[model samples]
Target chain A: MFTDCSSSTTSRLIHLYNRNGVFLPRPSVSQFSLRTTASTWRCTLSIRSSSSPSAIVIDGKAEAKKIRDDIKIEVSRMKESIGVVPAEDSSEEEVLKYVSGFNDDPSVHGVLVQLPLPSHMDEQNILNAVSIEKDVDGFHPLNIGRLAMRGREPLFVPCTPKGCIELLHRYNIEFKGKRAVVIGRSNIVGMPAALLLQKEDATVSIIHSRTMNPEELTRQADILISAVGKPNMVRGSWIKPGAVLIDVGIKPVEDPSAAGGERLVGDICYVEASKIASAITPVPGGVGPMTIAMLISNTLTSAKRIHNFQ
Target chain B: MFTDCSSSTTSRLIHLYNRNGVFLPRPSVSQFSLRTTASTWRCTLSIRSSSSPSAIVIDGKAEAKKIRDDIKIEVSRMKESIGVVPAEDSSEEEVLKYVSGFNDDPSVHGVLVQLPLPSHMDEQNILNAVSIEKDVDGFHPLNIGRLAMRGREPLFVPCTPKGCIELLHRYNIEFKGKRAVVIGRSNIVGMPAALLLQKEDATVSIIHSRTMNPEELTRQADILISAVGKPNMVRGSWIKPGAVLIDVGIKPVEDPSAAGGERLVGDICYVEASKIASAITPVPGGVGPMTIAMLISNTLTSAKRIHNFQ
Candidate 1:
């Protein structure tokens, strides 16, 4: 069904949280956060791809962990310096109220509502409630509209798609004039990714379920980005030889050989595609980790913008 | 440049004004423009291509003129029935003030700020002032963002792009699975046209100035939509055989032969394109006329939505 890219199948793209990742400025964190600490950004250290010398294995897991750790340290340090405790958010309404308070608070530079909120609450309303200036996730329609429009800049870009582009930039992959195909059209990932690729001067084509010949269309791509969360849906045949593949799909599949009878896999058939694709991102360590790193990056950027720090 | 999709090279695609028929919604037009009295919308009476029987010539100019006439009749009739005279607006700030008043006045269905505002005013600030419900131009970021999104719908669509799609639909030109190429990335026409094409299930590609080999990209398209406003930039050689061409470029060109010493042209080489493609929209009679028609249509839709008169 995933191979079909069919209408019957629904896209499972959703933003995940690490319990504390969503609601930032947890009154427990310090107001003195983002205090002009000039540490090397250590964004990435390129490790040559095991499969191809031209490709690099992007270690997103390590980078994401470092960012989380960095944020934690900064929060603790700020708490010690500024000494402010965030009030408890006991309910969904309380969580929203807390977020609203942060919107006006100059100290709080970013705000985000984790996706898949307990079904009762309206997702659009919560995302809309975040002040445009503080909307670090960039889920707000205004931010997205700004991103899509020419001569307009969004305050923030959605993290996963941003991470995908960041990986390409960090890796020095040139996609100009190239036939780039983005699989899936979920608002958060595929659509924005296509826009980002276009911004980079790539000839972009979006492949969705309605596509009459998805395989034929995909095979023409010099840069193929697959975000449909169906494991191993893209085979080696679907990709052009030497094409750069950015696989944003992640889903748990049954595997008796693993410690748990389940293993995480991406949309692309990594084993076979590695032979044909010049470069490719692996499932567990791919766009997943970079997403969190990008969130922190956006938050830092917001703080810098708010404080007018270079 | 205005009629030939000429080689005169003047139109570099700057957003234009009423002087060239780009912006619609002249204030002299009555406020009760689109009173919905359901009659079969005489949208199109497609004329088969003189060059090819399979191709239908979309007469946008006649349709637009008819629409304007219809609107004039309805607006005049309604103004006579419900007596409310709209105040005149002269300055930029006054124009903004007038629009805001319309926004709050439930009687006023849609509001639009004509483009190419005078050099002194902040265009974005003025546009942001319009209420979302009343933003008939569909230029507002929120509306655009909704259009870009998968599960969201904009209250209105930008006219030119919407006209392009409506032509394809009204003419029964198939879009699904077609490799559609959109030239240019302007927010007003090109970007939205690309998005609308994608929504119609075409595997869409966008080509801009930075495109290394635009010809190569365009050759792959089954449907080519050019809105670059660069006079006759696209040659007959650039087109694929039997491709569907929708040229959105309109610029006035200097011509010594004409009495006025000038003529209208578009972005495509119409003479060349018409010979090569199975279907093509003429420079003056094509996308231009449909734009105004769409504005009146959008206004009518807005009125219907607001009044629930359907």
Candidate 2:
């Protein structure tokens, strides 16, 4: 019964992790079979041995599906009871004007402005214009500041980092008093991931382009998160003996035999890391699926808050 | 001539570093003698040997005096040409109304709401009410979020952490690729200090109350910042040899022979740290003086920006 529900949830939306790390949905009957049968979604496990790789693969697809199932029920209940549904809109009009329109609209629960605005547009100014209350994307500076601060809570957390933390929570990984290292310091992923880890009472060190020795820090982490967007940058040797690894980076590398002449890879060298790590998440079906799930979750939360729904 | 000018600058304001780490001015003629000859303000250096403490003392008092002198000239020039001066007001009225009044006033360049409000008032709500443009204290979440983001700049940085960074810059200390550890996570000092260090390309690790082994992390830092308010909590053995130390924590310790039966001490055991560190800042004369200087500097910046005075 559980398997049937999860598979149905996963097949409802086909998510593609684009180069910009945004997940776009495509509804297709043909892609359904490919998703179930693909090695990407398989939860592979092996017994620990010197000859064979052995690490518990975290099934992010199933985990995200489970979360979505719970959110689906809550959203349904919210809509049925309050007659309110979350709304979103994308427009090419003057950025500030469009943002302000959505900000003032009573019906709009959440507002997200797609990134990489035209070269002529000032990205910071456009983002700053989004009303903090309706900023479901959680990119607003005020939201981030509150997230970084102790005793303060952000209305919403950025989807990808929130997904990473959710995965850990689902797995029951202990964060308190643990040393965690995050590679890359991009505002969206690495930086927020580090902040979240620190908030959970884990001591966090951020490694970046300017870091002199990343391996030294990585070796000390009980939990390691890498979001540098480099293919297989973290080697097997970089893993602590039993560290839980969360790789947010997904990059395409050419593979002639693979579908579309390419395959996805994470910052971690998975085949080698599997031999040493206690648990790991695969590149294609890992953080990518969870990111989309978090977007839906945030939208639901915004709607609930807006309508004062329980 | 330089000495005479510095003494005059120092004497103009009789500043005290109060319990809350805020500098309060108590104008008085009698305080002048205590200001100059007091051991608190004196910069003491000893020869390097087994028998003597060797670290070069960072004279924050002299540096702050120099910075204030420069700001004074600029403020005078702006006032003469534009007929505008920075204005500040503290009121006991309702917080939001008072904040909005200052936010709308054309002549008010900066707004600072003293912290630790009455029990009935929400602190975050009051801080958030201050206009970001006039937030001279830099406590707003939006400013902090901007400070943490790459390629983004905050209009104002909190005075204490800004002072810490300015002191490093003035002394020509390097940040890029260095390992820095901040020993606190307060919204005001330690958190922002860590963010500022990371912004300068330093790999930063924050050690807090829940950190399993703070000394282990502190020993690895090339630059160490201790802002936890525990007096002499960081021992000399916790420091890496020849590291640059910035001690922002100041607490009053009992001293029978001292005035008011108390003397200020920093997080670091200065007597022991001076022997191991390459350079160190003394508590009362260090970050305290620079904090007030940054407040003046930030106000000057706000005035110049408001009036378009270069």
Per-candidate interface DockQ score:
0.49, 0.63
- lDDT by residue (A78-187, candidate 2, tens digit) is 76898766433334346588678779988876676444465667778877888876775887777888899888888788989999999999999999989999988888
Q: What are the candidates' interface root-mean-square deviations? A: 1.4, 0.5
Expressed as tens digits, the lDDT of each residue in A236-300 for candidate 1 is 67889989999997766544445685567777766557767888897789889889788766765
Give me the displacement of residue A36 in model 2, in angstroms.
38
Question: Which 10-residue window of candidate 2 chain A scores lowest in summed lDDT?
Answer: A1-10
TM-score of 1: 0.73
Error of 2 at B109 (Å): 8.5
lDDT of 1 by residue, B17-134 (tens): 2424333112221121111111111111111223343434567787678777876776565457554322223566776786777788877756765454667767898788988766
TM-score of chain B of each: 0.69, 0.74
Local lDDT at B294 for model 1: 83
Candidate 2 differs from the real structure by a C-alpha RMSD in angstroms, to one decimal, of: 12.8
